[model samples]
Target: MLPGVVGTIQATEAVKLLLGIGEPLIGRLLTYDALGMRFREVRLRRDPKCPLCGTAPTITDLAVHRNGAGGACDVSPDGHPEGVAAAVAPKAGG
Candidate 1:
């Protein structure tokens, strides 16, 4: 998702949630265009086959989401951090 478009919608919804003045975009997705001045809403639905949110979820531990390599980071094709295992040995108990 393009962060510029999505981030604006999320920021707007967060303010609405704080003020309680209008319905927040809870359980729904919104797309917007500033130049065209258009807004579109798509209702979100729970996925039965999603590993993180499925009915019989397989991913139970938050540790699974953590980097097994600790602080090491790998750059994704899109330039985001993905975990990479530590290669150089460390002195024990340092």
Candidate 2:
């Protein structure tokens, strides 16, 4: 049931994007609470300090991925893209 609902939403969004009709959730996140039967929309903002889309992006090309896993541009040996910062949460009480 949850998969059906989520799939329908994804299909609808794809159709809207292909047809260029109606407002699509581009930078907004749609969260569904199945237990409470509620839906919430969260507007996302671009982080200026982000390495990918930041004002001064360090990674401007995909050349770093050339030496990825088996030279397949999948992922580096470090389990993250080269020249990009890996998202790591701070340890609790560290």
Candidate 3:
């Protein structure tokens, strides 16, 4: 799981660069106080070998499907649709 500090830093940097409304403070920590709560500091991480953000050049799309039973199905590599059974609740009498 990513630390909340990382998310906050990314969000703040994005807002500062894109909107140019707030001052960009990379080294110093920023705090948010709201609704009787307070938050402090932010952290950031980078994906070294991530295809989307790295030097590699390979990409794939994940297609998701839902059947009539309201269950999700994933398409296999061989182009076959893998069916997932829906969870059913047993009757009280049974």
Which of candidates 1 and 2 reaches a greater lDDT?
2
What's model 2's lDDT at 68? 62
> What is the clash count of model 1?
0
TM-score of each: 0.48, 0.62, 0.28
Superior by TM-score: candidate 1 or candidate 2: 2
| Model 1 deviation from native, Cα RMSD in Å | 13.2
Ranked candidates (TM-score, high to low): 2, 1, 3
* Model 2 C-alpha lDDT versus the unseen true structure: 0.66
Of 2 and 3, which scores higher on TM-score?
Answer: 2
lDDT of 3 by residue, 12-89 (tens): 789888988777764444555454466655543343343344455233332222335333333233432221211222
After superposition on all C-alphas, the RMSD of every candidate to the true structure, in Å, is 13.2, 9.0, 14.4
| Model 2: per-residue Cα lDDT over 5-46, one tens digit each | 778999999999999999999877786668999987766667
Best candidate according to lDDT: 2
Worst 10 residues of 2 by lDDT: 85-94
Global lDDT of each model? 0.58, 0.66, 0.46
lDDT, candidate 2, at 81: 33
